[model samples]
Target: MPHSERPSKRLAVVTGANAGLGFETARGLVYQNYRVVIAARSEHKGRAAVEALLKDCPEADVRFEALDLSRLASVRDFAAALRERETALDVLVNNAGIMALPQRELTEEGFERQLGVNYLGHFLLTSELLPLLTAAGAPRVVQLSSLAHRGGRIDFDDLQGEKGYDPWRAYRQSKLAMLLFSQALQQHSDAESWGLDSLAAHPGLARTALFEHGVRSRALVGALFRLTLPIMTQSAAEGARPILHAATASDFRPGDYFGPGGFAETRGAPERARMSATACDAALAERLWQVSCELTGAMWREETTT
Candidate 1:
């Protein structure tokens, strides 16, 4: 039998699963008996993550596939390959993201680095994978947003930041875009009767490699963050709770956003978090959806597989 025709267990894909919250999300999904794919840009790190997962649960169904969000071609190729091998995708965690980069950089496609990798990349990936997701009885897509989204502005005039670039501003826009995308996707799904759930989540100050190695890590802000880690941060596993909940919970609405439930939503169990006025703007989401589709040349697959 061809690989695509073979019967298998429920399947999931978690981008950036090589470490941090993404790894923990994959771990939880594997334990739940889903055949999880650890999608990351680095083959070595991806394989290592698979190894670590298997070490804990030797029978866990998990493997790695290369996916570099910085390149739109890579996103397309990854989606195409997965479609050839899987008849359905039960869950997709858009978890991979690059935090603040000190220097202004552009992706292979000339997109702002942070926006390209964090939001646009996932946008295209989810668009490409729509067919596989829709084939499942109940599919779910989880987008990773952040607290920083509150300060985000779309800045359509300078989405690429050609005029001016501030690391945190770019990061904020990307995260807010993720949240807006989640809501927009849910709306689209409802309108098209896609029968899929789309939700967003935030980790609420989790201490992960992204924080330790990102732009903030180099300055006094980084020092302060590190100093307050014990009191203000949670582990990656803790951070994954909101994502896992958003991905698997039955009671959540299609467009709900999840995050930590403690004071200022810094750390606690998963729960519905507050949304910024900008994030709730349906008009903006629609505009972004159109712009993203134009930028990535993404077309949501309308056909469904049996």
Candidate 2:
């Protein structure tokens, strides 16, 4: 089905909308006439992003809300605030994430920074907002994943990176966990009849600021990224296309993965991409779900039980 024909009575919340792909995704949704709330950690950045959107799309109903995905308490606060203001939510873009930070850090909640922010925070936020999403008809949750997931593995023993931490490895594992969470969410939602569509998307190798956050050698990384970026990277706007398609496209299905259709799935138009074998492991997904509930204390509503 064409995007124009998709249902429009939807409210969308996109995390990390201050810049890069998140900003682009919000812009696309606003262009489609959706009431969008851009969630960011910094109030200044959030307000600036919303103002920028308004500059381009004067009719855009975009607003900024504070949300620090690394902290579970902040996630709860944001969710509670949203619940108080909105009766229903049609779309959630779990698009905010950190990548390749050189330092090994933990969130305020004490989980590995990458895992907490990239996966668990979204996990809790989504569960908390499930009721609002259920109130809307055919709501969708789009999780931003990464091609680096191909090299990821869930280290049950070192989920917090206690054993060791490599920035890239940690990021990859967190993204892998995100894919697993999206698949598990689809399964549970279907069995329990929640009527929510959970899909995952990757931006491929888009040249975004994700790598500049904590690199020890920013100049070298930036130079290398620029050198290879032409071959591997896509514009942030183009990188956001799959996410918009997954959230707004009619044919999107639960558990479906989307990404670039180009070389190494790096830089091209959006397409339904293949998930790694680990991402499709139901048993692992279920275990991860259970662990997530324990770690984040994110309880599912009765409606989410299979």
Clashing pairs in 2: none
Score every model by TM-score: 0.96, 0.93
Q: Taking the tens digit of each residue's C-alpha lDDT, what string does model 1 give over 115-229?
A: 9999999999999999889988899999999999999999999999999999999999999999999999999999999899999999998988896776364588878887888
Tell me the TM-score of model 1.
0.96
- Identify the runs in model 2 with alpha carbons over 4 angstroms from their true place: 1-9, 212-224, 302-306
Candidate 2, residue 103: CA error in Å?
1.4
Positional deviation of 225 in candidate 1, in angstroms? Answer: 1.9
At residue 88, candidate 2 shows an lDDT of 80
lDDT of 2 by residue, 1-306 (tens): 113233445789999989999999999999988999999999999999999999999988889999999988899899878876777889999999988777899999889998999999999999988877887787899999988888999999889898898888898899999999999999999998888999999987776777445333467766777678677778888889888889888876678999989898887888998899999999999999999999999987733332
lDDT measured at residue 180 in model 1 versus the true structure, 0 to 100: 97
